[model samples]
Target chain A: MMGQTAPMREAAKHAILILGALIVIIPFYVMVSYSLKSPREIESNTGGFFGAQAPMVDEYCVKVGNPKEDCLETPVIFNYSQAIKKAPLFRYLLNGVIVTASIFLLQVLIALPCAYALSKLRFWGREFVFSLVMFCLLIPVHAIALPIYIMLAKIGLTNTYASLVIPWTISVFGIFLMRQFFMTVPDDLIDAARMDGMSEFSIVWKVMLPTAIPALLAFAIFSVVAHWNDYFWPRIVITGDRDLYTPPLGLREFQGDADGSMWGPMMATATIIVTPLLVVFMLAQRRFIEGITLTGMK
Target chain B: MAVSSKNTGFWFVAPAVSLMFLLLIAPVLVAAFLSFTDYSLGNQGFSWVGLENYIKMFSRSTYSKMISASVTYVLLVVPLSIGLGLGAALLINSVRHFGDFYKTIYFLPVMAALLAMAIVWEFTLHPTIGLVNETLADGCGAWTETVFSFGWIPGIDGGQSWYSKGCQDSFPLWFGDKSYSMGTVAFIGIWQAFGFNMVLYLAGLTSVPRELYQAAEMDGAYRAWDRFRLVTWPMLGPTTVFVVTITTIRSFQVFDTVEAITHGGPSKSTYVMMYAIYEKGIQQNLMGIGSAITLVFLVFVLLLTLVQRYFVERKVHYA
Candidate 1:
């Protein structure tokens, strides 16, 4: 009896899952669609998926005293070019790369050594320091945003790029994850390095770092995706300095006073901001999923 | 173990220890200390008002509403997202085809920046020209309207149904209406969040031993629900706990959607605690009350985490 109804049950499950998937895809569809659409299409809610590639006049361009022919361009070109022209989007993407890269590299520098010590090296007060790590993991850094912002403000470090990157330099979860991974490394490998006259510090860089690449790659994905997508810290620290804005902060600034005519460019900006990570994730779905779900393993 | 290597650990851990102290430990202590005094930026002096800010938090309606809004958000987002996540996970796990396709689509939200997606969602939910209303309005006087209106059931007059009423006039201004703002923000929150939880639950589902299911079958658990209750839920114990704790914390820190979409508006109906901290502490520079709220927020988080820890110890057992 169960076998008889199994196909029907499975089809029902698929139907339900399809409905949920459609809901998930709506905003993404809107974002990409709006990016390709003319302002009229957006306001009227017309253009089916991609707007008609109609060569519409950009009133803003015309209002700037340009030629009518010069202002005449397709909505796709107008939206994307206006997005770049309206804001230094390239600079924001560059800052995003620099910040996420620096944070990840610095995290590895700090976490790898500490995790190595905790997992491999025998030292005084090791257990206690490890306990401190466990405790700090419970303290969400965002919760402490009030005090940190106050401290940064008092030191007049609020507007600097340093302020954005400094607070996230020490990642306790990174330390914990690396430590767990390091514990599984055979002690014979470290002893072998020591026998080969490599110093402990050299061993960390030369031997341990190379072997920990897979874990490091996973951690890199986790860290970069997080900081890249992070809006909260950058919002607080990079106040009013449009030059220092990360991608999300830049998008927020773009939308701050955006009127109706700017929807096309605004979503173009969003699509630009969201595209890099989405592209990377698509290219490496397995690694990205494994890297992100690494949190769940803890 | 080499006793000579003992010195390496201290030097190895030094930078991380110092950083952890300066960045993590110090801010928490600073938040605690600042909660008692009226401090502001560029102010030379501060006078301690012991428990005054805390008193204000408990006594004031605004702060009270902030607490309720946050609790309501967590109460709504946590369970719904987790249930949706678990359901999606179970369904996707059981299905034989297109599993990866659905997984990728669901996780798109988790990868995209929340602020950007929230903006897109704002556009999608716009009152007049938005896709939501446009699509809903299309169903008016159509078969979807009658069926969705529940007009077929006896005594279920079509006029009284929300679907019918929406068809009659319009849907609520999703993020603009006071009654609906919190729900809409929570909906966006769930949209961005459940995918992560689903991925986590999917990971958990994989670790459930196949032999246990076979054993359950041997025990005459022929029905799907019976097999699931016997095998799946118990094996997913640790994942469920972790998912709940993480989702709760994530839900508590929900500021991007509020900041971008609502700005805690519709008469502060969506005034969550994180936004409250930002409004008071940073923007308004009311450091005392902000710190007080921050402290209260920390206490709630730590308490929730502690409860999860306790429950995990007592209830979650691996057989």
Candidate 2:
């Protein structure tokens, strides 16, 4: 009787799990399917799996309405090319890469030493500085936007990538994350390195860093995803220059213009923008989850 | 070794500390100072007007609306997302097979760029061609021809055209109408953030001892409510605090979604304090007023954080 009950319970649990999984996956399935559908089919609501019929690719290509005659109707043929041509996609992508990479590099440079000092070094005001760093995390970025904008404007840095990347490079959150990871490193290793006549910087570089690669990679993923997805700061800073538009801004541009509403191209742009982050997260799934869990635990 | 260690530490920390001081601390101080002035972007100089900006902000009708909208959004999104997250975590925890697959699927939203996702959601929520409405129609048989009568049930043509040949006829613009925009925004916000909170809850749930649940079961606490109350709720206290605190702070700082989806309006319906600050300072060049609003928002968040810390620390049961 107990064995039978256990099986029944386990089956019930599996049923619940399957239902929950469907709720999460269905939206994503719809998104991907919509992305593949022709514009007319999307408009006519005929492309749905249970609908009248699956609209063919030709219907969507014509609806995509690329001015360039090079666009053709074939299986898997869509007007993504026209969408790319309409905007400075490569330039936006370049800016995103430059800004995201620059910010991540700078953050690591700044956070590593600070984290090491907080974790390993005993200083006069160590606790106070550490507390202040944590306090910084509580202060919402919105609170500083106005003043930062004004200050950046004063320094003639408004509308420049520096305005976006420079202020963002110094993240207290990253320091805190790195500090937590650094705390796990054995003090004996540091002591041995010091006894070998290695400088503190060298100890950090050779000893702490090699051991903290997972933590750093975790933080890198966090930083990269955060900045790449960011629309607010970039929107404020990168004005008047279409060339400076990030993928987010570029997609917004596609929507706001007189083309009415190009669902096909917009979906295409969205797909392009989201794919890289998806790939990165999948590739580093374990590390990403670990990083997130560690940060949340704090 | 000790002597060199101190010097190296100082040298190493100098760059980060200096940058933090300049970028984060200095601007906050400047913002505090600017709040008291009547500075505008057009003016080369400004005279101090103590409490004037604050007074003006309080007196304005629109400011109150913005505040209410933001508050409503935070109140709804934070709790709902956290609840959904905990539910997802609990369900996922029950299943041993395909656990990683389930986790990955749920986490997709968090990994996807928000800006891009917001655009996609905008498409998904479109009245006519959107998959949302289509799903409702086919799955539930719900339809409405009129905006006012578009109930959840399908097949009722209330004489509303969801999409017109022109751009003018899209019914119930989610971000345009003041009455419903905040709710719409909150719904999307919850969807976007539910995954992050779920992961956190999953981690917390993992640490809970199974023996407690087994004991409860042996004691005949087999009812759903009894099991959850006796076993799950107590163990989730720390995670609850963390998730709620972070979600509240994040909700208060909502700008990217508003910027991407609404631009703060069909009529400033979605304009939270942060977006207002950005608009006034960055767009309109009203530096002083913008700074004042920023300060006000800062104080509000700080006070809330203190309250949360007080309650959370008191209630947290650390194992």
Candidate 3:
């Protein structure tokens, strides 16, 4: 009897989970499907999920006074090509890469040494510095946007890449995470490097960094995913500068000027903006989960 | 092996210390100092206005809306996301097959760019010709309309059935309706957030020992729920606290959805604090009021986190 009921219980669990999975995937389904469909099909909600792969005339192409025949193309081709061309999307994506990369690199360059110092070295005022990091952890960057923006404006730095990357460069969370990680590095490894005439800096780079790769990888994933998806800060600082737009800002810009006919390319843009991280996440599910949930680590 | 002569630690930490001071600490101080003044970017010199901004914040209806909207969002999203996350984690934990598959599917929301997904959800939730309305219209003929309707109960009439009513009339203009705007934004926030919480809870669940279950079973906890109560609940105490604190903080910081989708629309029902700060400070350049909101936001976060730390230190030190 118990054995019989076990399958039923499993089936019940499957039922609930399947419902949730459907809700979650509905947007992704719409995103990918709309990216493939023509605007007419999207507006009419017809032609099925994959659409008919029908030849659709590019209205914008004709609006630009191209020959009507020259404008005729498949919806898929039009959607993706226009997605790239409608804005400097490639530039936006490249800027996304540049900003996220520079921020992570600077965070590491500042944080690793500081974290190592806090965790490994016996120094006066070390406790004070660590306490400061703990206190700064409470200050979410978004909350203090007013003063930060004012300060940046005073320095003549708004609408610049430095504005996008500078405030986040000092991530106390990274400092804290790395310090916690560094504390676990066996003392003997550092002592051995010291005995071999390695300076503390050299030991930090040569010994501790290599040992902390997993933790560092986790931090890297955390930082990259965050800044890549961050819209609030970029939206504030990158105003009027299309060249400095991140993916989210680029998408927002596309939407702000868009007409009804732009849905296909707009979704294609959305998919393009969202795909890189999504694909990476799907591929490295365990690592991504571990990285994100690293906060839960004691 | 003692090399205290150079104090290399000072050199290593100085840059980070100074940057932290400038970026993090100074902003809080600046916001507090500027909150009492009419400081704008171009104006340079400004006159002090003691308690004026705070008075406006308390007196203004718009600020009240902001406070209510933010509190409502946090109250709703925080609990619901944590509940769903814990539920999903528990369900996935007990399942023998396709656990990783469910996990991958659920975690997709967390991984996707929220702004992009919000746009997609905006499309799907579009009032006309969107997937939600279309799907609801499809359900008009099917038993789905009947099953969901509570009209079968004698006291509840067909008019009382939201599902049937929606099927009869049009479904809601979800993000456009004031009554539904904050709820809809909160829903999107939940959709994005619970996945992260689920992943965290999954990690926490894995750390729970098998021996505890055996011990509970030996203690006459024969039923699944019994063992869960006797073992799992106590074991998960720490995870629960951490999840609650982290989710609360993240929910407090919710801006992308409200900014992109609602813009505090449908009568400012979604005027969250972050958006308020952005609108007042960045867009309109009201540095005084903006800094006031920012200081309040900072204090709320600081107090909440301090409370969380106190709880961690004094309250939930589990076995």
Winner by DockQ: 1
lDDT (Cα, tens digit) per residue for candidate 2, span B242-316? 788888888888887787778777576787888888888888877778888888888888888897789787977
Query: Per-residue error at B223 for model 1, in Å?
Result: 1.0
DockQ of each: 0.87, 0.56, 0.79
Better-scoring candidate (DockQ), 1 or 3: 1
Model 3 C-alpha lDDT per residue in residues B247-300, reported as the tens digit of each score: 888888889888888898889999999999999888888899999999888878
How far off is residue B161 in model 3, in Å? 1.2
Q: How well is candidate 2 docked (DockQ)?
A: 0.56
DockQ of 3: 0.79
TM-score of chain B of each: 0.97, 0.86, 0.96
Q: Candidate 1 — which pairs collide?
A: none
lDDT score for residue B182 of model 2: 80
TM score of chain A per candidate: 0.97, 0.85, 0.97
